[model samples]
Target: MGVSALAEGGSGTSYPSHREPDGSIGIKLLEASSNRKNDPRAYLYIVDHINPGTRVSRRFEIRNTSSSSQRIKLYPGAAEIRHNTFVPAADRHANELGSWISIDRPELIAPPNSRIQLNAKISIPKSASEGERYGAIWAEVASPSVKPGSAGNIQMINRVGIRVYLDIGPGGDPPSDFRIEQLTPGRTEVGMPVVKATVNNTGERALDLGGQMWLSDGPGGLNAGPFRAQVGTTLAPGYSAPVMVMLDDRLPDGPWQVKLMLESGRVHHTVTGTLTFPEKPATWGLPALLDSFPLWALVIVGSLAAVAVAFFLVLAVRRLRRRRRVAQ
Candidate 1:
């Protein structure tokens, strides 16, 4: 996580800044330079987990805090998991683990406070199956070529990545499967009240869904709330994702029995859904149709609608006195 070079009177070259473990200031390249004994070069990078025709080579470091002469570059991109976080992919490239990675050197110049080590290698193609694979490990710097009356249009490429977790095996970790495939209790075209659900990854890794919901069958020990979902939901495997959970119009229109729960490590899951709420619409709006009944059934249907409105106001005042005595 480092990149900052737009140069000139502003003096470029960045993408590497650290010193946090209580010290402070750590955002020069996204973070990860926790001063490993005074900046052991952004504390190195890659993390792998073998088994699958293995072949590794990790090595990374690139410093040149500038004094002129700094042209770094390197590649391997593709890594995303939106929402459930784990981003990394700016100047994207390749795809499947950046095509199995390979970056010995594509460009470098350093000089002036120098420090440059490369080597990225990662060959796993014995059919390469199993699970987990994301990529990233960039480090570019060059920015200061835009003076001609500058208002440019493009040219502002400052990079700083570092995130690669390639695991391929049935070995240690890579099994967080998934499932919660259906909950759908709707209303949201304006009538907002929701609770959708669907999350099937089915194992082999990639997930970031979260959960919580509660409300049950109570009668005198009332209790109904604790709804919290809409977490960073990522799910990528057999792919499937959608997990809404909205409801709150003073909830309570019967048939509730919620109680959902969910997790992703050591795997956990709980389910029990049913949240009905549809029948307050006759163009609804009498305090939402008396707040959807049940307070002794809206006081016995409002006392039988006030005795049928006093029997239709005694037949409309006896037919208005027989049409005013037959138009006297």
Candidate 2:
């Protein structure tokens, strides 16, 4: 990005044109030579183009024809170039200045009668919303550093604005919308369980609901269903549909987890419920006989009776031994 003065053979020095960090042509500043009584003028060559969502590095060359070293300051601002009337699509007004899509450093220094080049690199954000963005890069020559009485007052303030047009395409698919709730068991004898799930349309667009569920041993457990629910052709905004899930009574007696899965095209979501069965007491054929024997108390009585029988046997054996001794 090199800009030339193209002076019309004037008496005083003229400033060079402004160029974007990229090689594109920008604004031009025309400064009258002190000896010549011509007024300074500014000109710009606006460049417009589309930038794909990618990192861009640009280099700009500024040439100084003055006798003293000059200081330049570059800044980023809204695009002021008039080459084309470009407005971002309505969905793209959220981008802020100096975001990932902004210029690197915006300042530079140039020596006398020589050219200075500056490089700028910008990275587009990955999370940036999908839409078109419009902006520009602005460069202005700050107060020039000069010696006393150097070619009249440095009267040239060069400004160049470059228009940036960017288009960010659509991102990955929207997130899945599914939730599980209201899980309960049917009856203790049957050991049946029922679960309810609500699937809602949380995305901006309509989604098709189709998938299955099954009981699993773990959170990632078994396929509960391949149960189909005709949630209708479309789920309007903020609308939800109810799905009832039932477990077979024949399912073994133990802790069980029910899983309900919902799928829309390639997207899949799952919800789970856990259930436990309580132990039941044994029963006899006769209702009265069931409580007739206090089993725990009877066990204690039997243990005491066995202890008494052993004690009596020991006493009888001792008496027999004494009688046998007396007879001897």
Candidate 3:
């Protein structure tokens, strides 16, 4: 069903608005509490609307209607709608809920005729595209008195969701985005480290790239670049460029953090990687050389060395016997 129909109280839409075949219906947006005295109602709150990031916090409320207490389970679910149909007006789909939004604490117990509130926070990706997204928050009732899982139980699952309409605008210069991929020791010595960063144009527009790498108090703690990148400058959407940062070998060895910074448009994004340096090489010289080779090669070389030693011992014994025979 179209998002607009679900929001405006239209009938015969594919999306169900309250009243499931099993007799469960979503809580209406403006419905009063069934437990008049206890305030058994549900509401939704959003922290931000424009930037389309996930770290938004959603809060819900439940009230106990019975004389004793009630236990409630809040299920966090999510569903995605296409970006095209999202409209900011009230006429858009308001109740087309997504899966239950995930909550840190899933269950709660309310005291006799008491009210309870629950909150869930989700991490939104910065790369979320601009568009209309729809999903629901489900509050399921689990009190034993409600026939515990019965369809007609006073314990009910209420659903509410927001229609997120994000518009970042079309056709602007793309933003430069960068992330650190790997960092490690480049040579066997205690120093000399190699760091790698992947820079990309995550936005819809092309980006002019300025990037740098710096070591924070560790192996080869040196700063590389604000390099003028040639490949990353005109990156199309989702294209990436790999840049390597090299540090001098004489730098001290220890735990180190590497940072990569990229500038595009008016913003800069920094990505980081962590690495540790060992006090010494695990092995050295011939023993280390053999250890570094493949197991089969090491076995063959060791076998040849054993044969050569046996042959030399046999020849020395024969020569000593011949000398003794001449003396006799």
Each candidate's clash count: 7, 10, 17
Q: Is candidate 2 or candidate 3 better by TM-score?
A: 2
Q: On residues 130-208, what C-alpha lDDT tens digit does candidate 1 reach at each position? A: 7667666666765666767768634556655565656688466555567675665656666655676766778776655
lDDT string for model 2 (61-163, tens) is 4556656665655544432112112322233224543464344445655566666555545566656565434454555554545677877755545554433
Question: Please, what are the lDDT tens digits per residue for candidate 3 over residues 45-85?
Answer: 12123343434454545555556654555553333332212
Q: What's the C-alpha lDDT at position 59 in model 2?
A: 54
Scored by lDDT, model 2 comes in at 0.43
**Which residue runs does candidate 2 get wrong by more than 4 Å?**
1-53, 80-97, 101-105, 144-157, 170-328
**Stronger candidate by lDDT (1 vs 3):** 1
What TM-score against the true fold does each predicted structure earn? 0.29, 0.29, 0.28
Q: Which candidate number has the best lDDT?
A: 1
